[model samples]
Target chain A: MLSIVAALCGLMLVATKAFTAEQIASNHHSYALKTIEHLLQQEVPATFSLTDLPYGECDNYIVNQISAAGYVGEIQYLTVWRAQQDTLSMRVVRHSETPGIGDFIDHQRSPWITQFDFESAQAFTTLDGVSGATVTSNSVRRAAIGALKTKDIYCG
Target chain B: MGEPKTKQTRTFSDGVLKRNPAWIQLLGLCPLLAVSTTVVNALGLALASTFVVVGSNVCISLLRKFILQNARLAVFVLVIASFTTIATLLLEAYAFALYMKIALFVQIIVTNCMILGRAESFASRQSVGKTFLDALGTAVGFSIALIGLGGIREILSQGTLLAGAELLFGSAAKGWTITLTDGGLWPLAGFAPGAFIVAGLLFALVKSLGRASTEQPPMQLKGES
Candidate 1:
């Protein structure tokens, strides 16, 4: 009986996934585009026109999605690396941090997220984190550092 | 408990009014307080939770006979968890923006004592038909509590109704926000403590109403029997 119930559940889950996968993907794509548009401060073209920079090649600007462990769950973000200046900027793409407090990482809520704008990744160690959201701040910092390290390893 | 011989008749009001899980029993306060900051968020969670509770109830009722008594709790939880996952996927697909706002609450519905409590106390013993009605009534009760708290919080915090209605209702709801005040009357209302204050007042109101209804007028000033 347990096996039967489990099997039924599995079947239902598979069916629901199959039905919603396309719409979910489309929604994610639109959301990503909107985020990129806001972060880049420009209208994205019909297709994503930003050149995808291959790793190991230092370029003026490059974008990479990185994930790091946050206070509540994984924090995924898009980081822009400007290797020539050793500066990085990031925007959170997805996270499960507590609302109101940790959510200050959002640029709309507070200017704290702008602290990452065009700053050396090492600056995170000296910067005072958001008063009540240290873990969330650290998560974004970790993601930024990871993105920088990736550039360092491949570009050099 | 022994299996009952017949299905028991119950009324919707019994769940919504007389024994509201949120107002009276206080079954699921975690998500209740966490996600009641806005009407859209509250309603989104309510919709997802309703689906989960109703689906789990129906499944559990159908499987009650086959479920071993010793393993029934595990089985019930498995069913509830499955429904929650499906609800999460559906929300991500249909209401992506709203889903992101209340994703944590929606994902944690599997642990909501309200859903699990109903399964253990009611669905495990009732027929599928009866269980469905019970689930609906409970869901309605929960929805009322959530939306009421959400409305009050949104009014106090944002000074608007349906401030982000578009997230749930699409572009048509873009203009649905009805500004109630020039600015927030109480910005704290947008936070967790605000949820507690409003919920406390709601609990007090319900208690007072229940007390007033149950209180009997003093017997005519007659000698004590």
Candidate 2:
């Protein structure tokens, strides 16, 4: 009797898990997209794509073309905002970091992120440091500089 | 032999105080250590564990007689795994955001020693009523320990109680987040070391209290010569 009851309950639970798998995947995808959109406001073209390039090889034309320099590091750069476009907005999306402390750079509380708003691509190398989150801050700066350099290459 | 009512009461009390799965027995340390990072996380884990424990106890007790003696362990695992899967699904459907945050830990509950421990030690041999009471007592004790650990971590680390209140208590409690830290200080409570230290302190405190209660001499019965 007990085995029968247990089996029945077990079957019910499995059925529920099967039913919700799709919903979980959908929610995960939507959440990821929203996070990306929030960080890189719509001023840049919405048709942008993400590509993984080697640390030293990322083509940051904005920094290289405008300032004659590039960054060194394995980074992801958001190539948005053509030079012809009056308004330019771009950013590096994510990085590996310890939670809570280093992760603050990803959130709005960190001044480091907003510094990218109006600064020239050359300013990426000289942005003020985020006191405790220096490593994460540097990573973001490198990625941003590389991205801007890449943008200048393709769009300039 | 049928156990006396007083013996059953004693067993139930033991589940709550003397042999609590979290504080005293020290079972299910995985979820206890992982999810206790925040009050809401701990609360959600506690509720889910309680449901599985109690539900399994009841179901197992009902099936005790007919279960093959050799296959009882297999039976228990299946029953527990089933409940855990159901819990994961329910969280996904309704509490989608929280479900994502606690995804890995929820599945890990399948291996929590406390649930399997109860099945082998108590549920397989006890009456349904006694098993129910025992499971309830054990679950409540575990919940208390989890919430206590979670509350301490949440307050000290984030400098607030219920920093993300809406996740557990709904939007009405959205503005209830208290700022304990001005984003200053290395937030120790949010990390793994913080969890180990807090759990260690709580364990020591409970152990000392248990010693004190046991040291007290029993009162002499009025009719005893």
Candidate 3:
């Protein structure tokens, strides 16, 4: 009986893994492309093709995706470069900040995240809360600065 | 305990309505109430619970002859845990977002009295076919209760139906969201306390209807006389 139970249980799990492996892999691979498309304000790409510069790319500009330590965990963001352009743009991809309060840093949750769309991270270094999410705001500020530093590390 | 012969139809209907694991029976209210904040969440959890219950019940019924009387409960738990693991893995591999949304709750399904109760009481004594029917009925009842509570909370809290539908149903379900009010009010309805109030209201509504339908007078107390 124990053997029967073990065999059945093992078979079921093996079958389940076999079935869902493809979709799980697909969802992971598409994460980068999805973030890129959202930042660029473009249609879903027919194919995913990314060009990494010494710095992050905007168009002909540089781009970088970096993670910064927040209150609890790392906050990931995408930075697009600006050459002739005056302002740089970045979007939060994931974070582990408190919900309802800190989540304001998310552009989807609130437009407060749009404050970081700049050529440099200087102005946003001491931004006040558009709402009341100061901790999350600071994390986003740090992340933007982190994105800028990547250029120094690579190109400069 | 000796097996009490039950009519096949009654056994099935009892699990579905008269003894709904979530609503009428209120067997597994913790995860049921917690995750029923949205249709997508409710649907995902319901699917997971059903898969575990049905799978466990079938296994218990088939193994009744082989399992010792004293060890039945222990084995039943082991069986329930195995199926729960299978359900969790399936969710992670195929429905990644849904898996993350109901992350903590999936394991809690093992402690759900509904699945264990059915395994020990009915599945251990009944035919595998009959146990399957009972599990199906119970699962359907659970799904209905979850969807009802989820609908109420979502409509009241966010003024939307099927918000984040893609979490369960995939990308095509992205457009399933429906706007209710200009913006939904009573956001608290999606929180823990809100679930308690809504559950109380549901019980009240059911009790009132039960009262309205019962026409017989109270039975006399012969023992006192």
TM-score attained by model 3: 0.67
Better of 2 and 3 by lDDT: 3
What TM-score should be assigned to candidate 1?
0.87
> Which sections of candidate 2 miss by over 4 Å?
A1-10, A18-26, A42-156, B1-11, B179-186, B216-225
Give the per-residue lDDT digits (tens) of candidate 3, residues B140-213. 88888888899999998899999998887789989999998866689889887998998789866865665567
- Candidate 3 backbone collisions, by pair: A56-A62, A56-A63, A56-A64, A57-A62, A57-A63, A88-A118, A88-A119
| Top TM-score model | 1
* Tens-digit lDDT track of model 2 for A11-98: 7866787798788666644554454455444232344322222112223212121111112223333333323332233433333344
Candidate 3 residue-wise lDDT, A1-156, digit = tens: 666666777787778777877876676446656766666566544644544433344345666777777665777777765665535577776665655456566666567667656535555555564456656667777776676677556655
In what order do the candidates fall by lDDT, top score first?
A: 1, 3, 2
* Interface RMSD, per-candidate values to 1 decimal: 1.8, 5.4, 4.5
Q: What pairs collide in candidate 1?
A: A56-A154
Q: What's the ranking of the predictions by TM-score, best on top?
A: 1, 3, 2
